[model samples]
Target: MLVRVLGSAAGGGFPQWNCNCPNCDGLRRGSIRATARTQSSIAVSANGVDWLLVNASPDVLTQLRAAPALQPARAIRDSGIAAVLLMDAQIDHVTGLLMLRERSTPLPLMATPEVLSDLSDGLPLTRVLSHYCGVAPLPLALDAPQAVPGLPGVTVLALPLPSKPPPYSPFRERPRRGDNIGLLLANPQTGRRLFYAPGLGEVSDAVLATMRGCDVVLVDGTFWTEDEMIRMGLSRKAAAEMGHLPQSGAGGMIAQLDRLPSGVRKVLIHINNTNPILRDDAPERAELTAHGIEVAFDGMEIAF
Candidate 1:
């Protein structure tokens, strides 16, 4: 199994435009030991030729340009994308689907029923393009093992995650239907398994059990603390409120890390620019390394 880190930043990306915060300012001035990353996305390949994109960020073109291996020998219209596995219906995660519209055939996209319904109803990319190929929405049953279309010997298991509180409805108990997911990929051919959760707010007992015996686990690392955005005055929201929990402080990533076995390799992805750990020289970065966790960066590749 070959796992490629396409982009590691959260929604707006590192050094996001329009605002000149210290991290952005330092990044622009080359004073801080920070790295520039795009929105969260990843690609996995069975033979390194036929690749499966985990999520299509808006920067898909740029990511493809960076990794020339992703382009098919044939024209962009004939490229071999086995399928696109959408984790959720967030805008940043699905905007890149537009690029597929330029292709000759309709793209096969796998997702939960709720996510599929949201896109089919609210954001219809099929209607946007004149040559817009339709999206073949495949249903993904939570925790049930299934095979990815066109990719034999590989299996994908959807791990349903808890959603954020209902914003519009005060009486709602669970979050909106289309909001959260995690993925577990198993390749019997390679005898490897990978667990990923980019938008997870909390790691459940079921998820922890599923993560066991995997070769690699790429978990969410959106915020370093619950009060991060509050301290920065960026928003009135807390990390937990946005369907992501912090990586540090009490009941956070570090605490959860202690539960995993030592053999399982771990990495944190979808990190925000406000995260001090972005800097290689930062103490936070050192701490993660000490605990055997890698902070993902764009262009990083891990092969098993």
Candidate 2:
């Protein structure tokens, strides 16, 4: 299994255009020891030739351009990307489908029916893309390992996680089963596994069981604390309210990660701009390092 961390920041990339918070301002002014990042997205490959994108982030163009492996080679219009698997229907996660409108062939999109419906009805990317390069929807069922159509040797297992609907969804009464999910990519050939959950609301016993004995685990690092945005004056909603579990505190992701096998490589992705972990000199960075957790960066590669 080969995994590439294309973009590691949360919805608004680090140094978000409209805000000048401490971390953003510090990075912009070269005072903070942190690199600028785009929105979160990742690409996985089994044979290193055909790739599957986990999420088509709004910054997909920039992310793809940075990864030379994803570029076209022999054919003028050929793309290495075989398909896209969406975890949710958020604008930041799916808007990049528009940038792929110029593809020579229709792109294969895999997601839950709920996510596909949100795109078709509310955001209408599915309907609008029909006029351009069309999209073929591959329904993802929870806990079922399905082989990616074009990419062999790779199998993806999705597990539903507790999450809220995207704010733009017309049916935002409450989240149903398929609103969001975690992906477990396994390589049957090598027996290696990777677990990814960038929109985790809570860590259930099932989620922990899924992580057991996994080679690598990349999880949500959206906020450092429940009141991170509130303390930063960025938003009124707590981290849990926004469908993200904080990285710190007693009932946080760190505690859960600590319970994973020591051999499991733990990484943190989808970090928010307000999180102080972006700073290299922050004490939080050292704390995570001490716990053997890596903070993901753009263009990071992990092979198992």
Candidate 3:
């Protein structure tokens, strides 16, 4: 199986247009050793031909242009993506479907019932796409592991996480079962598994078990500390209040990850613009290296 990191930053991307935070300002001024990144998303391929796009980020267009593997060179007006599987319905995660409206065929879109409802009703992305390049919705049932259509040998199981829905969702305050989720992608043939949870707010016992069993774990790295945005006066809410687990401190992502077996390859994704891990020489980045954790970057490829 091959996993490619299309974009690794959170919703705003690094050096976000409106943000001049230290990391963003430093990178923009060429004063920091860091790589600029786009929004969070990834592509998975079982045979390196047909690919499954995990999330269709707002930066999808630019992300695809940088990924030659996602460009089906077989024919004119073609795409390598066989299907799109979404974990949630945040604007940053699903708006790119509009960009794909030019496709000659309907899009194979998969998500939980709740997520599907949001796009079909409140968000209405699916409704808009219906006019052009229609969508074929595949309900991802969390009862058990099911084969991801189009990607042979690859199976996906939905693992529910504790998280709030997007503000536009009617049930934003009343969290539901499928509102947010992680995925367990398994190659039955190779017995190599990957656990992906890009927007996780907290790591539950089930989540930990899945990580322990998987060969690789790519989890939320949205904030370096719980009060990151609060300290910077960017937002009133702390990292936990916004449905993300900070990387440091007690009961944080890093502490939880340290408990995982050493053989499991651990990586952090969905990094926010203010996160200190973006700098090459920052202590935060060095700390991750010391703990054997990698910060996901655009164009990163992992094959197992």
Candidate 4:
């Protein structure tokens, strides 16, 4: 199993434009010890040749350029992105599908029925793409594991996560079970498992079990504290309200991560720009390291 962290920052990305916040400003001026990051997304490959993108972030074009493996040079007009697995219907996660409209064949898109409905109705991305390379929607079952369409030997199980739908969704207030999900990927050849939930709000029993059984767990690290955005005056909603589990406070992400077995490789992704862990010299970074969790960076890769 080959896993790649293509981008690690949350929605607007680290050092997001239009906002001169400390982290963003300091990073731009080279006064901070942090690295620039794009919006959150990941790519996984069973054979290393045929890659499966976990989410098509708004920064997917830049991510694709950074990872040469995703642009295999078999022909002048070819791509190594075998299929796309959407975790939700959020703008950041699904907008990049437009950048992939140049593909020769209809792209295989797997997502929960709810997520597909949003793109088809609310966002109309699936409808617009009909004129382009088009999309072939596939099923992502919550009851059992389904084989990834383009990647052989790789299977993924959809676990219902505690999260809300995007604002554009008509059912935003009436959140459904399949509105949000995390993917548990298994490599049959290596018998390695990975739990990836970049938008987790709570660690349910099924999520806990998935983490325990997997060798690698890549999770949401959207906020450092529960009221991060509120404290920064960026938004009125707290982190929890936005479907993210903050890293600090009682029963927070760190506390949950601490309970995992030492053998499991734990890593954090989808970090918000306001999170202090992005600063290399920050105490928060040290704290996570001490607890055996890695802060994912763009291009970070793990092979098992």
Query: Looking at model 3, which ten-residue stretch has the lowest summed lDDT?
Result: 142-151
Against the true structure, what is every candidate's RMSD? 2.5, 0.9, 0.9, 0.9
Taking all chains together, each candidate's TM-score versus the true structure is: 0.93, 0.98, 0.98, 0.98
Q: Which lDDT tens digits does candidate 4 get at residues 66-166?
A: 99998889998988889999999999899999999988899999999999999999999999999999999996888588988778877888988867799
lDDT of 1 by residue, 8-116 (tens): 9988888887647778789999999988999899998877777788889998888888887787777535565778988887777888999777766668888877676
Clash number for each model: 0, 0, 0, 0
Off by over 4 Å in 2: none
Q: Which stretches of candidate 4 lie over 4 Å from their true place?
A: none
Report the candidate with higher TM-score, 1 versus 3. Answer: 3
By summed lDDT, the worst window of 10 consecutive residues in model 4 runs over 139-148
Candidate 3 runs further than 4 Å off: none
Error of 4 at 18 (Å): 1.5
TM-score of 2: 0.98
Error of 4 at 59 (Å): 0.8
